[model samples]
Target: MKSSLRILAALAPLLLAACAPQQLVRHQGDAASLAQQDAREKQLAHADHWTLQGHLFVSNGQDGNGGTVTWTQNGDRYEFILRAPITGKSFRLTGGPDGAELDGLDGGPQTGPDAEALMRRVLNWDVPLGQLRAWVMGTRAAQGGVAQLSFDDNRLLSSLQQDGWDITYPAWDTTHQPPLPAKVFARKPPFMVKLSIQSWTMQ
Candidate 1:
């Protein structure tokens, strides 16, 4: 029994080492892959046509609203539609070089030069549509604002801040090629928006 105890004690260190997890190492290959992904993201930034279907939740200090969102982007033009199933109300916002037009089931079309400001006044939701175009792609907006960004172990964007908004990518579509954000949350003081993307189609 004494010899058996001694043998087991001698093997403990080996057993412990075998059970330990391997240390993660970042090498040149990892750096190259990250650079390639960065280049791809930059290419996607210039994408002229794309469509996204998703569910969105928006909240302000007073109330919270949720609905389906369908956004289509074409060059400098964009069309955004939001619908609240509970109330059966829908709003459409379109913007181009001319200006921005917002229409809803409750009122006539409202026109303005800025879509973000228009949505805030019309729907009472302060949504930054221009910055969102880049943010939704897991990249920061190029408006030259101070940005703070973080990456996950996979070298994918985990969170970012720009233009007074803090955005988090809690989940992504890893099953698809060039993984895209699956769930995102953006927040500013008194306002917050959450998005769950159902489908993405790029043209």
Candidate 2:
């Protein structure tokens, strides 16, 4: 009985080592996965054409508005529709790199050199719609501006600052290829916009 007990005691250390949790292994694997995800995002930045349908909330110091937003991008040409359900008002914005045009529910077509300026002028909302095309996909816009970017534990974009607006992505839609921001918010003091993407498709 004494010899048997000694044998069991001798094997205890080996058994415990074999059953130890794989914490180090898991952390290393996670780091590799993060690197892969970062590479994928960088490649996805070149994608210029895609569609997104979502909801938007805007506060422009004077008033607050909530509505549905449908945005479509095809190369340099893009179209965005913002509809306010309560007021039954809908606005469509379409444009390219050189300029943009806005069609309000109550006014005629308004053209401008910039989409952000047009929105603020016509809709009384300060929204950076042009930059939002890239922002929604978790990347900085290409119009040449300084952007401060932040990443999550998984090396995914969590927040960014561009053109004086601070943007934050709280959740991501991992169900889609390359994954995109499920919910994003941008604030520049007097102006604030919240976007929630319900669907995303890439081409």
Candidate 3:
């Protein structure tokens, strides 16, 4: 019995060493996946001309609005339209490098130098349109530096922290070339925006 115990003890160190190689391989695989993901993000960053139809929900701790949303983007120009069937409220935001315009509101048409400022003043909604342009496409914003990022098992973006917002991608449309986000949720304290994308059209 004493000799048998000694043999088992001697094999324990060898067994542990065998597992070390597997651990190293797993670590290497993770690194490779991250590298691939980074390359994919670079490609998506340049994808500026596309349209997406989705559902958007926004909340500011108390008041909330939910509706069907359609966003069309062409280079730096974009047109965003939202329709709330239950409330019979709707709005359209169209903008480019020159300026921005918001229509279908109480005070009639409103124009400003930027979309974010216009929406904040007219609708009282704190939305980061510039940053969101990239985020909605599953890439980090070009301006604000990202604080952290996490990936799912498929090496797709799972969650990220950037510009004071915690953004998460719960699902992806794997049918696309590089895959696109199907559901995106972003929160910053009292403000939260959730998007459920139904279709994407690339140009």
Candidate 4:
């Protein structure tokens, strides 16, 4: 019995050694995946000319708005249009290096120095449109440092914190190379925005 026990103890070390290789392989695979994802994000950063059709829902912890949204991007210029189905209300926001213009409000067209300021003044919603241009594309915003980041099993961005906002990607359109966000949800305390993308066109 003593000899048998000794043999079993010796075999236990071999079993543990066998598991170590698998663990190492898994760790290496994870490292490789993260490297690939980083490369993909770098590539997407340069994808400035693209269009996306999606549904957007925004809430300010009191009032909520939902609509079909179409966004077009051409270099530094962008146009975001949101149309409410039931109310037939629509808003168009266009901006570039020069400035931002918002139309289809109660008053005449509104213009401001930037889109974020204009949105807050006209819509009373504190939305980070500048950062969203990158977040919506499933990448980090170009300007700010990320506070936190989490990845899914597929090594895709699952959640991130930046500029006091917590953003999450629940689904991805893997049919596209490097995949694109299918659903993006972002919240900052009383403000929350959710986007469900239907299609994407890169130009």
Candidate 5:
């Protein structure tokens, strides 16, 4: 426990280092990314509740698997629940950096390497479950990333960019719509994450 905390603590400063204003303003993506970041932040401040269900494919996208994710945010903190289907076996994980207990896992404090851990390092986002939930859904939280966001239809948060990484959302609903799956495409060379919106609803 102590070692994990120390590792995370040590990481905090490095993460902050990457968040210098210059990085955010200097992303190499086209103008669309900046516009989306701005637009997404604006929409997030107004949303009450949002849930995104989709097919999550990782590790080169050849896994041929799917999953559903639901996010609920009351305020600064939110809960992201993910259930993944891989090779006929199902696994679920719930919890964020700020949360003490993940809902459906039993073992020790998972102090090992995993996809989520990699994302935390690569993205430098360690907000509570709800905070990230909101950001992904278009809310701006305390994430230190050289990021820019853009929106489509001027409401639903559209795209985001951080540290040479970028996400482009193609399908978006403009008029305060629901049941819209905001697809975000991420690129970072050998690592890619493609998320598809399968369902959306208010809770």
Candidate 6:
């Protein structure tokens, strides 16, 4: 269930190989077992509104390129825009990952497949939008049957193992109303997406 995401050049093409420390956060009790408590925590941090800017990429055992995605989540409604460098030109794309609406510089009201195609035209590679948000936030979807979840000293979602996928969060600041992720790592081999939140806006 991967969709194409476009990467901006100024922020793209930086998919160089880099390794980070294998970190483990201590949080007692299985979170999945405490659905109500976990849900409470999610509601507590509560993202009434969230906006972030960063580079994103996906790999399938091939060369990957990074793209810039400016995402803003307003309550349940969201707006996601992507831009990537390809063939010495920059293409802009704006839409919602959960199928909100589409407004692109390329024109035409596009659907999911169409939007994905538009970004691929500029990024020169396919992007996985579904995974992008999950990685950026350092959390999994509420639908995911989380086997276990833990928090770090920062009270941020530190680690999660949902549906056999391992996720790690480092450096989080809830100073924002919706909370902001400093960095997130989603490792599942062949598709390890890492993100660094450059700036955050909460309202």
State the number of backbone clashes in model 3: 0
**Least accurate 10 contiguous residues by lDDT in model 2:** 10-19
- List, residue by residue over 1-203, the lDDT tens digit for candidate 4: 32222121211111000101111121222665668668878889789999988877665565555667788889999887777767666667788989998776565688899877776665555566667777777777778775566677677777766887777777789999979988877777666667788998987
Q: Model 2, stretches more than 4 Å misplaced? A: 1-38, 114-117, 120-130
**Residues forming the 10-long window of minimal summed lDDT in candidate 5:** 11-20
- Which regions of candidate 1 are displaced past 4 Å? 1-37, 123-127
Backbone clashes (count) for model 5 = 7
Per-residue accuracy of model 2 over 119-189 as CA lDDT, tens digit each: 55554444556566666677777773888666665656666678876777677888876777787776676
Candidate 2 total steric clashes? 0
Local accuracy of candidate 6 as per-residue lDDT tens digits, 94-195: 444454234443444444444445445544434444434454565455554544667665455666665545666666766754465666655554545566
Cα RMSD of all models vs. native, in order, equals: 18.5, 20.9, 18.9, 19.0, 9.2, 6.4
TM-score of each: 0.77, 0.72, 0.82, 0.81, 0.52, 0.60
Stretches of candidate 6 above 4 Å error?
1-21, 26-48, 85-110, 113-135, 138-140, 177-179
Error of 4 at 166 (Å): 0.4
Alpha-carbon deviation at 83 in model 2, angstroms: 1.6
Q: Each candidate: what lDDT? A: 0.62, 0.61, 0.66, 0.66, 0.42, 0.50
**lDDT of prediction 1:** 0.62
Per-residue accuracy of model 3 over 32-124 as CA lDDT, tens digit each: 567866787887877989999887766556555566778898999998777765755666778998999877655468788987777666555
lDDT of 3 at 55: 77
Question: Any residue pairs clashing in model 6, and if so which?
Answer: 3-127, 4-127, 5-127, 7-67, 7-68, 7-84, 8-67, 8-68, 8-84
* Residue-by-residue lDDT tens digits, candidate 5, 6-124: 22221111111111132222334356654555555564456666555565543322222234554454443444455544323233333334443233333333332332453364334
